[model samples]
Target: MNYFTRVLKYGIDYSYFGLLNILFNILYAIFSALAFVSFIPMLDVLFKQTEIVYTKPEYTGIGNIREYLESYFNYYLSNQLETDVSSTLIIVVGIVVFFFLMKNIFNYLALYNITFVKNGLLKNLRENLYSKVLNMPISYFLNKKKGDLMSRITADILEIQTSYLSILELMVREPLTILFTLIVMFTISPRLTLFVTLFIPISGFIISIIGKKLRKDSKEVQQQQSNFLSIIDETISGQKVIKSFLSESFFLDKFKSINSLLFKFSNKVINRKNLAGPFSEFMGILVIGVLLWFGGKMVLISETISGTTFIVFMGLAYNILTPAKNLSKSFYSIKKGNAAAERVFEIIEYNNDRVDQKRDVELIKFENKITFENIEFNYGDSKILDKISFTINKGESVALVGSSGSGKTTIANILNGFFNPKSGNLLIDNNNISQITKESLYKNISIVTQESILFNDSILNNIKIGNLDTKKEDVINAAKEANAHEFIEQQLDGYNTMIGDYGNKLSGGQKQRLTIARAMLKSPSILILDEATSSLDSKSEKKIQDAINKLMQGKTSLIIAHKFSTIKKCDKIILIDKGKIIAQGTHEELINSNSSYKNMNELQI
Candidate 1:
């Protein structure tokens, strides 16, 4: 489907609003033509061209209705003129004013109804983008920039909203205005109306050529916008790195380059889009000039069209220009918005192949064990985990310790279903992990990662995120067990105190402890700790390690830690090197038997 058509589908749910909008627009179109047509009688009166009808006209069929109405109106004018010409002129002007007022009222009503459809589409589109982002697997975002994704969700969607108004109006309002006006023009003089209608396709074809170029340029503008936004994101996130290396000039130059591209392409799109309005108006005026010459000859020489009627025909022709210019504007707008629409719909329609295809099996508990059998995974051509296998029985705490880039975190991620192994099976109590329903599997599992992840929300809310039904006392108890209760209570708002972005308001240890408390509150039967204390100092590490141990009690735990001290008490420790497990044993047994494990332990100690 065309990208614009796909976006229009989102408004289907607001059909009633669209129906009302179309109805009111029909009324507006009728009145819009009537508003200008009403002045024809006044013009006739001014020109002393009003025929005095002594007898009222009889009712006629639809074909002669225009002639009948004209005669009746002449009869009324003649009677009124006999009394007073000034009063009759005032009455004619009054009728014209009434038609103009009705035209605007119906136009306002049409816009009021379309507002519901417009705002509703925006709301629903934002929600769909957000929900898609949330459900999308971690691997899906590996090749995408966070800042680019942010731009698609925010700026590009806004572009779609602005263009959507033009689309809706183009559908019913503008065309109807032109249609009704043309019908009246045809009635006054078919030759002039045909002449005007012939000019339309030529004007449209010219505007279309410009629009085609604008589409390509508009895409470049949107892409450049994404590039600058990505640079901004990187600059903000790596500010410390840039400042530490004294490389502000390098980043500034980098941003300026992308920003310059954005500025150039944006101006191109804007300049081309602006051409549409003026060109359309100029074409309308050109056609109007031809009408004046052609119709003036008919009125004066041929005497086929009357002088007063020709003047009224000119008024109707001018009325057609406003809708003509707006329709052209809509054409250019859709061309530009097509780029943004494609960007946004790409995310919404992303094929996340990592989502488990077989989700019928429920994993309500970790009753027996988790077994990784012949697991193989890769990032493109580079292997991250190869033919790997390990197991952790229920209620047993197992640790994976390895050097950096040795696949410890990768293994933990695979176990957590964040990434599917290229070839292998992960089993929970003999049930294929990939087949387990995500909701049920997640319900039984909790993870505390190396970096403390907390929202900018109250302390109590952060802990209660995944476990919203947990009572306050249970939260406090969980906090106490994780060694976070003292610092949390020390804050002015206690549990209600707000944590800043990524919990930056708290110390490294406080952040880590709060994460532990959040995990403990869930009370999951299976827990995974991926270097929960790697960045903390020894003092903080000891406090967090104590919390981890307590959170692991009676729970089947998988720990990926670099600091061997944190996992020494695990039931089994697996040492991995270069995507392969070199040894697996209890810490004491590994220290006694494996020289690699012994050296790593000695080095850390």
Candidate 2:
């Protein structure tokens, strides 16, 4: 379906609230017209045009209800004029004030009800976007910018709220107000009303032509904004690298370039949007001028309409312009809103190729082994892993040794179900890994990466993230096992110490130890260490290595290490070169047999 249809579908899902707004708006429109129409009688009283009646007027059937009400009102006013002309004018003024008050009251109620639906839709849209982002596979984010996704969720959604969602008011109140005003105008003078109708289509056609470029311009503005936001995110995230390289001016130039494009697109969009209001207003006044010339001739020459009635018709005609202008603006806003909704729905409706299938069997524990049978994976068109086959038996620690681009980390990613091979069957205990749910598979495995990923939270909460229900004693014990307890205890608040963003307040060693502590708390059946200690100093490496040894005991482990010394004691080592496994043996066996393995080991030593 089209974007507009999709947006309307979302609004219709909350039709209960929308219906309430519509009902109140209908009342508001009716009362608003009556409030202006009440001016007709007051004008008569002021101009001394009251028709005096000697007796009460007879009630007529509903078919002639309009005439009957007019007669009844005249009879009451005539009697009041005879008694006290000043008092009769006072009563007419009171009735006019009452109608206006009721009109405003209904208008307020309409807006109040619409607010609930508008805000509620925005809340649901954001929530759904977040949930989809969380569930998307890792590969989905590989090509996406953090800032672009962030813009979709924040600024783009807000644009939809203000531009599109606010159109809810125009949809109900403005159209109904114009519709009711037309009915009153037609009753006063059909000839002038028909003349007004002819110009409406012409004005609408002109306004639509002006707005033809709005959606395209709005899309450009939103895209430029996303680009600007992406640059900001990249700049902040890589501030350290930029500062270390003394490339501040380089990034500043990049930001200014994108910002300039954003400013240009914004100007174009606003120029088009602002044009709608004035153009519609001018067209409306032109219509009014024509109506005055024609309707005045009918009143003064043809004598078809009275002076007071013609004045009321003019008021109704002017009132129609307000809603008409609002309707035109709403159309422009819908175009912008449609553009934003397209961006939002792109993320929400993205097809996740790596979605897990429903699994009836739960992988509660790893018993036998994890095997990769003839695995072949590709990154775009280039092969990353080719016919790679290996197995790590239960409680065995196997290290994958390879060059930087030799797909060692890809194996770890596949093992954790973050990705699936293009052609392979990964099995645990002879059961296909794809048949196992990711949640249950991840529950039995834990990973520690080269970079420590920590939040800006208390150390206690950070450690507890591995297992929320973990006890305080268990957290301390895990920290102790990772050789982190001593440093943690030295802090002012110990476990309760608030770690600044990404644990920036802590040293590299301390941060790595905290991550190890988190993994240790999970205590999974299988563990994958992807150069977890590669970034630490020798002293910190030794401490973390000791923790790794403690955590790896009696657990099936896969190690991807840059330093051969870290994995020298593994049960076996698989040496890969350019997406193919060249050899597999213990370190001593590889050193004696394989030249590639011997050379790598020599360089590290």
Candidate 3:
């Protein structure tokens, strides 16, 4: 109930449909009551209770109107030449038709208003959730499971929109209608109403017992479903690896086991949830039978309630039980929605680890020095970098040479502000990096990593993502500079040729060159290249290095050197070992002065 109440507040202020919805539902209840009340006259006609036993009319103002109408009707009936059965039959038929029409029209309008409220809130809620995901800090995504996050964005929010919204509307409207119907039943016979109320607690207890198992099973089903989706995503993305390793049957077995578990849990949840409907209706019919027997005996002995009155009272009692049975269903749906809402809110409520100050430093350009002072970082208990320090002048190229796991990529990540050092500080032109806004910091740096990220878009559009407003000629120029223009022009559509997901349609070298072209378009003050040419052949590497040399002109660059030729061209080379700088000098100077650099250089050759 707390979750339902909280979620409603999110929509109530955002749209006026909440107000409209409540108004129409109330109108629906009123008209439904009036429709049933119209039966009183019909029952009187059938039971011969419409004789003129007149009393004086006394009223004031608009309150006098009903008495006036009643007196007029009685006067007309009394003066009629004949009181015939055929005329009464026609009158009863007219009353039934009129009441049925009123009931349906009001019901239609109530359902219509609900459609507007549900779709409007759903639109706004999805938009807000998407905006929150995009604006949250990068660190927030690192600790989350992609499949569970996907479930929140796709399945859980949709459950809130579908089941939760429907249940909420029913919880409000049906209960009010039930209450009004109960009041009418009491007016007809208080003894019968009391007898009905005695079964209320018993029906509620049964519903509660059945629904108690629903939430736990619902949670389990949701978890298994997410795991299944994750496995599918993994298999699709790594299809080549799976095929190469010949583990298709192994993965299939794993998937089948997970699917079986999901099926079992889903059966449990639905079985428990679905019991509320028929079981509740059965109990309701039982109560109605009990009422009939007791009320029939009372009617035989009592003069106040005729058989016709008793029959109409029974109809109203059945109407009350209809909504009561529906109430049990709505409660079950709310419990299911509670499980979904918990997962959805978990993602939207996670605390982003990166904090921004009230105000941040803004630098239009880089001028002085970029310094890493005694930096340390750990991913949980495993330290990735330790007490590392380095500096780069405004317009110089510095390369870091190391084997795998020697912290080359980590340094590149730290420089691009993708990660924050756990200890010590980084400075740009003497101002602390933490003081700068992420947008401003990113404006001064560009990265081209080993994996070339490209969307499924035209080559022209892909490069233009570096700067959306970049002109066509500008894209071609950047492409030429990366040595991608010659190959791209050879394609059938030239720059307009579509690159598939992750640029799968292109070769490794071609994708890397396109990535380099994207970075070239940014024209950043600092460029960080993390083994960007590692996937290319020597021929492609040479072409890319030539492009890199041209691109690094007048820009401070940190190259995570994979090629011996590229390392020798840097103004200085730093040898890193175990997250620390063990040697620093020219390629020739290091080779002369440091054993580690000589060994690495010799190994590369």
TM-score for each predicted model, relative to the true structure: 0.98, 0.96, 0.92
Cα RMSD to the true fold for all candidates: 1.3, 1.9, 2.8
Residue 301 local lDDT, model 3: 75
Q: Is candidate 2 or candidate 3 better by lDDT?
A: 2
lDDT for 497 in candidate 3 is: 94
For model 2, what is the alpha-carbon lDDT of residue 91?
A: 94
> Model 3, 318-437: lDDT tens per residue?
877778888998888877777888887776676654466532799689999999899998888988888988888889789998878888888888877777889988889988887888
**In lDDT terms, how accurate is model 2?**
0.89
- Show where candidate 1 strays beyond 4 Å: 353-355
Q: Per-prediction count of colliding residue pairs?
A: 0, 0, 0
The TM-score leader among the candidates is 1
Error of 2 at 228 (Å): 0.8
> Which segments of model 3 are wrong by more than 4 Å?
47-49, 53-91, 486-497
Worst 10 residues of 1 by lDDT: 162-171
What local distance difference test score does each model get? 0.89, 0.89, 0.80
At residue 355, what lDDT does model 2 achieve? 47
- Tens-digit lDDT track of model 1 for 1-605: 28777887777899899999999999999999888889888988898889889798898699999999999999999999999999999999999999999999999999999988888777778888899999998887888988888889888988898775557766689899999999988888888999889878999999888989998998898888888889888999898999999999999999989989988999999999899889999999999999989988998899997888888899899988888898888888889999899899899998865456667898767789899999999999999898899888998899998899999888888888788889999999998888898889888989999889999999999999859998999999999999999999899999999988899899999999999999999999999999899999989988998998899889999889888878888999999999999999999999999999999889977
